[model samples]
Target: MRYIFILTVLLLSFNTFSQPISWVEQTSGLTTQLTSVSVVNDNNAWICGYAGRVLRTTNGGANWVSVNAAPIPLTLDLHSIFAIDSMTALVAGSGSSSFLFRTSNGGANWTQVFTETGGFINSVQMGNAFAGFMMGDPVGGRWSLWGTTNAGLTWDSTNFYLPQAGTEAGWNNAFFFEVTSGVWFGTNNTRVYKSLTLVNWTTQPTTGQVNSYAIWFNTPLTGFTGGTALLMTTNSGLTWVSPASPLPGTANLSGITGFGSQWVVTRQASAIYLSPDNGATWSTSYTAPAGNFRHIAKSRANNLIYYGVRSNGGISKGTLLVGIEPVSNIVPDKFELKQNYPNPFNPNTTIEFSIAKNSIVKLAVYDALGREVNSLLNSELKAGEYSINFSAADLPSGTYFYKLSTGDFVQTKKMILVK
Candidate 1:
């Protein structure tokens, strides 16, 4: 059975093999599609889209302010953006007359960094505050790549690697920048370009012919590149192995990003897939909140994951009630038993409970006939939030009940297991 779940502040939650994550919507005050997002931190981010659109959030998306680009034409589609801080960022627009804009005064002023006629910019990335790179569609049989050592003040266009002989171009949000000066970009050539030392670049073919739209690397040695299916690499991009697609065989992956050690992949408006063990196995954690999910960003300061939608004109914040992060920092004021996530679960789920004061806690699950099937926990507790995993690998799928008892507080919640 398909399972859909939601979480509350009480902290009672669960996760079967198929657990749903809660996505909270953020108002962008615009309806245009936000195609790119660069999360500077938990409280600062920059989002860009069509019509020279740029949105900045400094207070963790509670409030978003618009950064205007008046001199630049509004009809151009700003498909790629890189935010260095609250006041400084770079946005690239794709069209017949592609242009790149930079702002240093928090949008009070804007400057045109570079422009190319009859070209389209697909991705832009910065390795440091003063160094960055940009890629455009093939021009004269060579993909356009430019480097800048002095921020956007000057760009060097003659220092590109040997060009391949094809109409090789890049997809939106297909670029990745590693801290060790590694750069990777997916292309319509069904190949991935990797620059181990940033001085030279090499292209490696993927297992499938579909264009890779998104790419992520947990470490320089481990990464996942997705197009029609998922390809994983353990020894960097030297080799890749095809993993089972998280969605059905027909769905194409739209975007992928990393949240701490966990990974997330989106399939447009259909679903969001989560991988707890790097790129090994994935499960459906939630459906797309709005429109089609184009990209997702995670804040390095607080590790908050944010989703940007295509044509939805808004962004959404999400929280994981299972996997690594079970709850935020808000502690409960009283002992309570909350609901389990993905109540109609499959082979696995999570159980969360809170204690207001230190007490002996006991948790056990029983079958529909009141027979105990599993003892999840029996521990000396603290006045904090705690969660435990409950895997029904050996139990038959059916109705099950879980009870929590601690001092005078005793409560039970019913869950369904459908294998």
Candidate 2:
């Protein structure tokens, strides 16, 4: 089953693998082809698809309401919806020449802020209202990038261009977001590009067409992108290479992104895939909100991944767990388990810890009694950094004990909790 989750608040001090959760169906009315799903935070999200279809819900994915947008004889195909903030957003699509829609009230109303210079506006992105760029297929199959400085009220039309661009049909998607710095991707020399000022589309040459069928970045450098083959670039798009993945037999990838720690990708159906180590490998257990999932969105706020799938057999709801993020603040404040961060904690926490040498580190927790209650970290850990989590919902709420053991280094700490 697929679920489009929405959380209200996010308290992130660290990044860690979060406990697994499922997606819940909030709305079951429309059946148009979903174009883009944008999530600003946990509780705020917007999804726009085909035939002037745009849905908004502030209550996560449990409920949805079509923005009964003030009638304007909806003409342009609303292919994408980008929630820049809970109030601000931008959307664009193909039909009716090419157009963009902006909203400052969570879709309560929308404004046709921009239109095409003659081409199907495949995707739309904005660094700010004063700085924006739109790219799409040209008349002769090539692609062009247009920029703006006046809140998209007017565009500069042409600054970056890609010759003989491939058809966006059946091709993956592209996105320009602020990750570490200004990052952009689509296909350039038939590959991809990354720019700082959204100009001078620097070509990061690659060997694959539609290499990043679906691309997403976390930092300007460290990101996971995939197409026919899964790819990971640690230094922006300067270099490109494929990673060895255990995906379900070279599955046709539709979209890819970094959620929490693992890399999430959608197959064709409601089925999805996950990679834990930057696409070097994959897991078959990954799942998202159930349905004939057409699109998915993830919010860094609450470590939740949502999906918009076709409610199977008359549009029903389902859920799936497709990826894992590290548990933020998983390390006991008094115990110490700090490693790296950006994990998928239920509430998005970070954990850090240090071990001297190899030992039987049993960071277990017991509920009330001294009996072995639950094992948060029960493995032969190395002598380096360690991070783990005692899932909030996995165990009951009460006094818990975390004991670490080595040869001569054995310590136990007590911690309190409130659900």
Per-model TM-score on C-alpha atoms: 0.72, 0.64
Q: How much is 109 displaced in model 1, in angstroms?
A: 1.8
* Candidate 2: 10-residue stretch with minimal lDDT: 2-11
lDDT of 1 by residue, 1-419 (tens): 12222222223333312223445567888988888888887678888988878888877777888886676577888999888777888889978777889988777778998988877888887877888888777776777788888877777787575485566777877888865848888888778888866568887788665588888887777788878778887788888777544434346667777644467777666466676566555655445446777777665455444555566885766544444334444556888777877678887787777788755566778899999765454433445576656678778889999999887699999999999
Clashing pairs in 1: 14-341, 15-349, 15-350, 16-348, 33-311
- In terms of lDDT, the poorest run of 10 residues in model 1 is 1-10
In angstroms, give how far residue 280 of model 2 lies from its true place: 3.1
Candidate 2 TM-score to native: 0.64
How much does candidate 1 score in TM-score?
A: 0.72
lDDT of 2 at 307: 50
